[model samples]
Target: MSEPNRFLALFDQVVDQTIAFAELVDRAGYAAVPVDTPALFLGTRVDKIAIGALVRHLLLAEAHWFEQVRDVSPGGVIPFPSNAAALEGIPDGAPLLETYRRSYAERRSQLEALTEADLTKEIVFAGRRYTVIGFLWTVLGHHSFHLGQIDLLMRQQGIEPPEYMEWPEDQRVLG
Candidate 1:
């Protein structure tokens, strides 16, 4: 495969892993980890936020970053509620997963139109500059970090999160 095709394939892998993991969590039932259930997030500061809030934050952050990279002015602020009371509007389970799917479909379509040269173009955001590919890598890494957090939340409730690290045969690019 060409370099551009190879790079784009990684995005597909990330999306597949995210959707697969979310499906596992959904099948386990949102009741398994109640929206208001406090879960510890090991960030710079230890936060015990509601699991639903964290899930909502992840979905919004992913979509926001994707939109930023696509040069689309976002419509509203990204939600990152500090407490359950602030997250009353956030939906969990299949509805949240469906929202992610829709966002990914839109972002993926934008990505498909970019050439390899476009990936190297620099863009400024929040007073910092980053190449298109660099921003994309950051987005994928953010997904990885949050996926682990979600997995921990699932395990805490005796729910088995989807296996993300496994190299599925279908994704293998055979020579």
Candidate 2:
């Protein structure tokens, strides 16, 4: 495939993964969230950042990076909340889930509209230069990490998390 085609294909893969994760979380049910999962802020531990904050955190992180790509400074993401206390002020569950869905959709639209040249251009972030692809890779990894945390939290609450997305052929549907 040509360069443009290659980038589109890769971008599509990221979209697929994001959608899969969102579906898994939706099916898991937020009402069953763990009251307390291991959480920390900075070096000193505190009674902040609960399981309820995880989804919002992941969604906001996606928005933060997307804003940075628009030439906004990392610190320019005003109202970007980093802790559970701040998130607690926001409505969660269905309200937040809808917001989360919109966030990811907007990010995907932004990426899909990028030209191959744009993807290859360098973006300086935190004194380091990275291609558009490099920045997205970081976002993808960060989101995946948080997804794992959510899964662990669910297990701690004795709620079986949704299984990983797999080939329909690999999974028996009517077993």
Candidate 3:
């Protein structure tokens, strides 16, 4: 396959992984994670961002990138919440999930339009300029990184995360 097609395929794979992991997280009930400051796992020094805040950040990032793909400033249809401070004014559970679904659809459409030539497009992210491909890889990396955090937090809270489920033809049941 051509390089662009390869990356596109990889991006689709990551999106599928995101969907699977997100389903598992929802099934494990992310709503159960406490929003309070003193409620982290016993003596754990790494609860810098509350669980609710983390979820908000994830939602915000997904929407932001979706808009960015269109060369548009992020926010018109939805108000952009503060990346870290969204925890203070937590968004509702079902609404946030709906927003996430919409953003995922937007992202898929944007990515579907990607071309090899577009890979050379430059964008600034985290104070550095990167090609579109690099920026997308970074986005996938960021999301996956937090997925790990959410899984760990779930375990610490006595919730077991679901095993990774790769797509296959025979598996007909949804988890």
**What pairs collide in candidate 3?**
none
Best by lDDT: 1
Name the top TM-score candidate. Answer: 1
Q: Write the per-residue lDDT of candidate 3 for residues 1-175, one digit (tens) a residue.
A: 6555555565555445544444445433555554556654433223444344445566677666655645633221222333444334435454555666666777777876876566666666656677776766777677667767666766767656665445432333332
Error of 2 at 85 (Å): 10
**In candidate 1, what are the lDDT values of residues 74-152, reduced to their tens digit?**
2323222233243355467677667767777887788778766667777765555677777677766876777676677
Residue 31: error of model 3 in Å? 6.4
- Clashes in model 2: which pairs? none
What is candidate 3's local distance difference test score? 0.56
Which stretches in model 1 have alpha-carbon errors above 4 Å?
A: 2-4, 26-51, 72-90, 167-175
Error of 2 at 92 (Å): 1.8
Clashing pairs in 1: none
For each candidate in the order shown, give its overall lDDT on alpha carbons: 0.60, 0.55, 0.56
Residue 96, model 3: lDDT of: 54
- Candidates ranked by lDDT, best first? 1, 3, 2
